[model samples]
Target: MNELLSTEEKRAVIELLYQLADDDFIISYRGSEWLGLAPHIEEDVAFSSISQDTMGHAAMYYQLLEELGEKDRDYLSHARKSNERKNAVLLELVNGEGHYLHEPRYDWAFTVVRHYYYSQAKKVKIESLKQSSYPPLAAAAVKISMELHYHLMHWTVWFTQLLNAGGEAKKRMLKAIAKVEAEFEDVLSLGPLSKEIVKAQLIEEESRLLLSFHANINAVFNDLSIPYKGEFTSLSGRGRFGEHTEDLSEALNTLGEVYHSDPGAVW
Candidate 1:
């Protein structure tokens, strides 16, 4: 009985849902690349678990879109071109040089920093969405929030351990942090429908969410006796506005390999 939304409200909701679903979809793919390749077996399992949970969250959002009379969840998740996607620019970047199946030289420090920053931001967004004007979205947020506790903890543990380890670990982490933060503005963005999304109360304003994220991460940094400028730049184009790097195109090509071969068994 939650079908009292106007056309505009529904459009905004759909767009926001696409952003949510697309962000998780791309990053979970990135996370999956680390399978069997994490620093150790235990971490291999843990990271795999997190990636699975994240993909499930993405499915939930796409299913919500389906309920709103959109395309099938399969097509939504698998068939969209990169520019049609609404994910943040940061999530679409490759893991590192070389293919995973080949001589993969992935950067663990970058992985830790990227996931840590993303986890914190996701936590903030989900908490806000729990109060979303759209009931289905709010409920989805509630369910997703339960699992995010572990997600945040896992990434935070890695971030903290690397920073405290000092020397090379710390240096690499600092570099990763800078790289991740440089593109974080788009991650926090609500896409081209920001005002409309905020107008519909699908989530809180980006400014407020940004403050919460800064405070949360700054406190974590302070605990480690590290200085955080909390600064971000628009050095990259807005993925939300259908702008993206070739990295996303490459990712889509790999991800859609099976789907293109046979959409029926895209799993």
Candidate 2:
């Protein structure tokens, strides 16, 4: 059985949980938008599975929050405003300019790069969380880690193949890498509560997490003979602090359409 957490520790834990849950929820929503619009039918199915897995992870985090006396999972997910969300801006950005239902100009290279980078970061974070001082969280980390191997392999294959194919594919992949790198710090960061979370022994320090993430990605680039300087910047505002773009506003409106209609209704 898990021990009761101190007030400060509980706050830190809740913050971290929100960050994990929101990030996965937003990204999975974006992935779901690509359901029937993927480049090919076979890939469409595989990608759907990944999206489902990601959303499942988000649900797990939200459930944890519910156990801690937060609102129910569905309300926490659908009722929260964009500014209230803790997801990184990278995940909230639209797949492209056009709507997902019509003429959706989704970028395959961006999808591959973003997924590969986020997956690596998540793996590092989960590994650290396996040693979390909170027993329930550490247990949850172990369960989540079981599913990550497949997620990592799936994205890594796409990342490597596209980078190796050369021609337009390679060019687009490189461009995507640059774009993702520019805004990836937000994804890797644990935000303003990082010090508290680390102090509570909930996870490792941000510096250590970044080191592991960079090392893993660097190894992949080296194997593929691609030049990687390994710089990550958060050009967009920090989502952890409740700052977000219009993209998140639009996403929340669309995703919450049903829930907002009747929040009190049991599903």
Candidate 3:
């Protein structure tokens, strides 16, 4: 049987879980919105796998939250307010101009850079969570770590292929990297509760995890002969503290539209 946790411990665990869960949820939703819009059919299939994996990870975190006295997973996920969401704004941003169903001009370079940068950060966090004092979360971390190898490899391949493709591809990839760097700080922040979360051993210190991410991303850039600043920036506000852009509001509208129609209905 599981032992009872103090209120503080529970809150830390729950909040950390929310951050992780919301990050995956929003990124996967954006990925799903890509659907038939990927640059090539083979990549479409591969990218879908990453999206499904991310969503599956989000579902796992939601299940953990359900066990902690939160509302049912469906309600908690779909019924939350925009300000309540903990996802980074970069993840919430649309793939490109125009609607997903309309004449969308999606940029593969942006897609590759964003996924590559975010995946590296997530891998670092999951590694830290493997030692989480919250037993359930630590166990989930173990499972999450197992799946990240494939996710990292998939994105790494895309990142390198684009960088090495030369000509227009390289130019676009560099531009995408610049854009990702602009919004990257949101991914690294642990919010106002960072100290508490670290003290409770729910996850590692944000700085340490950030270092790991820097090394990982640096190696990728080195191999591609691309220049990388040792640090990341988030000219945009931090999402960890609930600072979000209008993109997130639009995302919530799309994700919750069906669920809100008949909120009281069993279906």
Sorting all predicted structures by TM-score, with the top scorer first, yields: 2, 1, 3
Tens-digit lDDT string for candidate 1 (104-187) = 999999999989999999999999999999989999999999999999999999999999999999999999999998998999
In candidate 2, what are the lDDT values of residues 1-267, reduced to their tens digit?
224788889989999999999999999999999999888999999999999989999999999999999999999999999888999888888887689988889999999898899899999999999999988788888988988889999999999999889999999999999999888889978888888988999999989999999899999999999998888888887888888999999999999999898988986
- The positional error of residue 204 in candidate 1, measured at the CA in angstroms, is 0.5
What is candidate 2's CA lDDT for residue 252?
93
TM values, all candidates: 0.97, 0.97, 0.96
Candidate 1, superposed: residue stretches over 4 Å from native:
264-267
Over the full model, what C-alpha lDDT does candidate 1 score relative to the true structure? 0.92
Model 3: CA > 4 A from native: 1-3
Cα deviation at 24, candidate 2, in Å, is 0.8
* Better candidate number, 2 or 3, judged by lDDT: 2
Local distance difference test scores for all models? 0.92, 0.91, 0.86
Model 3 residue 130 lDDT score: 86
The model with the greater lDDT, 1 or 2, is 1
lDDT of candidate 3 over 1-267, digit per residue (tens): 134777877887788888889999999998998998888899889889889989999999999999998888888778988788787777888787887888988878898889989989988998888888888888988998888889989888888987898999999988888899899988878877888888888898988988899888888788877788965666666788788888888888888998899998887
